[model samples]
Target: MLDLTAPSFMRAPHEQLVRALDRSCFAETRIILFGKVKLVLGHPEIQDMLKDGGRFAVDARNAGHASPFGMKFLPASLRVLSDNLLALDDPRHRELRHMVDGPFRRIQIEQLAPSIRETADQLVDDMIRDGENDIVAGLCRELPLQVIFDLLGFSDETRGKLHDVMKGVAGGGSAFDVVRAIFRLKPAQAALRREFENVRSHPRPGLVSELANAGGDGGQMSDDELLAMVFVLFVAGHETTSHLLSTATYTLLMQPGAAYQFRRLGREARLVAIDELLRYCSPVQMTKPRHARRDMEFHGQSLKEGERVMGLLAAGNLDSRVFRNPTQLDLARRPNRHLGWGGGPHMCLGLHLARTEVLEALSVLFDRFQELALDTAPDNLRWTKRTGLRGLKALPLRLQ
Candidate 1:
């Protein structure tokens, strides 16, 4: 059994376990995440399972079972988060995805390139003025949060409130901490509901306004679902991209050859480099748990209906059969079908925006500073303990 929740794996993922499972697509192995489940690490098999909505489902209801999470105990404010597109089955998921998909399309996101770069330059200027060194705190976290807040049309006050609320919510560790967090979140929850209503009557300039008015052929989402949708947007929109920025920058600092090649590439080639960077350090280590829709064998393994299986995306990225020299950071790697941003219907909606941010961020950064290097030793660098995401706690760099 692999305890992924352990501090060791959180600090830095070792590839030995993945190497051990190289002979098979998947093993009937025990792994603890939400609970014990079968783990898949092969690239082809995992990607296939992810794309096969008929065979596997994110919603347990589609598999004829109640949600395994004891979510009923949670307040409606919190419970509504589970009503997101990620938790829905076909038709509904497809519909919701299509409704919210307009703003995130590559063309729409590309229009924001100048503003994104402007924000990046401003952040860089702040870093230089303040003599800030921790890239995670100084640039990685702030840039994405600022961009998302701007995109959502959130006022500065709302951004501050939401920041505190999110910190309070995610900071909890024990039962006492959980109780404290719920109390802290109560006021913010009510305020956000009112904000959503305001968006309906008085339009805003961003995605929030469009989504607030959105009603596909299936009809409008309820207040709770709307809140959940926005919540998903706020969290997913910034969080994963921050990690991507942090880790990708760190990878570049670590590999000079890769960075050199990355710098020499054209715009299209640079985006490809970003794709390779995503695979090299998977922002999300694994896809959310998927359940079997029926009693069936998968890739030679037998199973029961509604059984849990986790796709180890990072390990899958390292599959030697799919990626040549899987461990090496090849900036020009072609046919990079790595599941870094995930794949299929549930693939990241903000991928275009994310790629834009990275491209502009790195371009402005390197173009500004001629010399950049890590301030702390690689061994001293820390990783976030939060499961499912891989990112640096800080990247202290000495730049000139």
Candidate 2:
């Protein structure tokens, strides 16, 4: 059995974990740190669970879920925070997804590429001015935050406050720290509610305004629901994309000739490369725990009703049954069915936007700074301790 929460497992190199899990028993069960929750490994089995929502549900409120990092939560605040699409079942999940789906469609996200490219160029320019810097802070972190703020039509003051709240939440420290961030989220939700109202009244040209005007699927969203959706997008859109940018950059830089090879590819080819990077990097390593709505037999294992199971997305991506040479980063890999963005109904809402940001960032970084290299030894670089999300804490680099 794989013990994901073990100190050795957490500290081991990421690739080592992927390879080990891929070769382990297909039905191997692992216990997570939180209340010893069960993790579901194996590519096909995970894919089936994600797609089979009737059997496995995303909403864990009734799964007797424990507080994150074993923290004690304020029930009221926790309830509000947990009301997003990720935790919703069908009907409501389908309704809200429909409302926002138009804004995140591929064509709509493509329309924002020029601006995304401009943002990337500006960040690269600043990096060039600073001879040596942490790419995580200077480039990866700021780009996604800027793009998401622009898309959401946030004011400077509101953006700063949201950033502080999310930064605290993303810090992912001890149980006390996690609980503190959960409490802090209430005020952030209030601030976001104000922004939503502003956009609703003024009718701006961005996603916030679109969401405010959205209805007809299941009537207008309640203020609480709106807050929950925005909260989910704020964290998902900002943190995940930022981590992808940093990790993809780190991965490419570490591999000899990978960066140059990626840059030389044509636009269509570059998009394909980004997909492969998403698969190989697997930034969001695991999905939120899904509960078995009823007792079910899966792959010779029995699960009782309300039992929680987490899909190890990273492990699935590296499964040899799906991708040949799964461990290698093949930029041109095709027909890649990786679950990096997840699978089924709860797949990432901002995937197109995330892809645009990462592609533009990579292109701009290499185009401008041809001699960019790591300032610190690869072993000295730090990885974030966050359990579900894989990302660098900092990546210092030498730009010439």
Candidate 3:
């Protein structure tokens, strides 16, 4: 078993992990036991496995250990929250997926595109006025959190509370950070629960309200389910995008020529560049793990039942065979199919929101801040130690 506690992957550029996976692939390796659990990194084998969900299950309980969030706090509807789409297998998965996927329908998210762009623009204007700033704190973090709060119909006061909760939860320190963050969220969770109770009488026109009131033949969302969804959206929506924006900013600053090209090429060009950035940074390095139900062969290796599979999305994004010169950041590359937001039925539900946010933020940053430069060496910036997250702790910048 690889000692994950050794901090082997920590501090190293994400490339090191990709290289490790690549080597393992050529060696026809399997079962990389990191801290007792084996992580399957080979893409071709993983893709084939994920494709056949019948044999290779994605169900939560059957999949693996309890969710990190669940480990922190048990909600009223623990079963529903745990067994929701992401935690279910096959036919059962399809049922819950239909409900959650309803709101994220392309048409629904597309309608919200204008709102997303406006939010990005407004935040950028503030950044430009501030002169020098930490884009992560200033623009990247605020924009997505605000958008998700708005979608949940959270009042500004409640939104402020949520921000504090997220900061305390995601910021620094040891396991105590989780305790602190959870304490901060308690009040907000109570407020949200109250709102959920009153939701039927006075439904609001946001995603949370929609899920709260989803009924009849189609909707499977329970009150507890709605609360869990809100918490997930509030956290993941902003955190992942924050890293994306920060990393993309760092990438562009490093490659001025590419940044200039992205700005000059217009909307379509900017979109293409954003796609590449998503692939390159792949903000969420690891995903919630999936467990194997029965003994199976993966990449010519036999695996026994009761084992887990953690998808290394970063590894897939940097696969040398799939992406030419995968290490280099190429904004102009076409046919980019990065697994940044993920794939299959459990792909990121807020992908449209995320894509729109990245596009607008990049456009505004490059267009307005022509003199943007890194205030510190990118190498000097420390990456967050969290295994599943890839982002800088501090991104100091000078905007003249």
lDDT of 3: 0.67
lDDT of each: 0.76, 0.77, 0.67
Greater-TM-score candidate between 2 and 3: 2
**Winner of 1 and 3 under lDDT:** 1
Residues 65-157 of candidate 2: C-alpha lDDT, one tens digit per residue: 453222344457677766688888787789888888877899999999999999888877787786638878787878877888888777777
- For candidate 2, give the lDDT of residue 6: 41
lDDT of 1 by residue, 120-231 (tens): 9888889889988777777777777788878888655567877776544432133344456656665666766777788889987877777777776858877777767866
Model 1 clash pairs are: none
Candidates ranked by lDDT: 2, 1, 3
RMSD of 2: 2.9
After superposing candidate 1, which stretches have Cα over 4 Å from the reference? 3-14, 27-33, 68-75, 167-183
Using TM-score as the yardstick, the better of models 1 and 3 is: 1
Tens-place lDDT per residue, model 3, 97-163, is 5666665666776777788878877876687687747777777777878777777786566667667
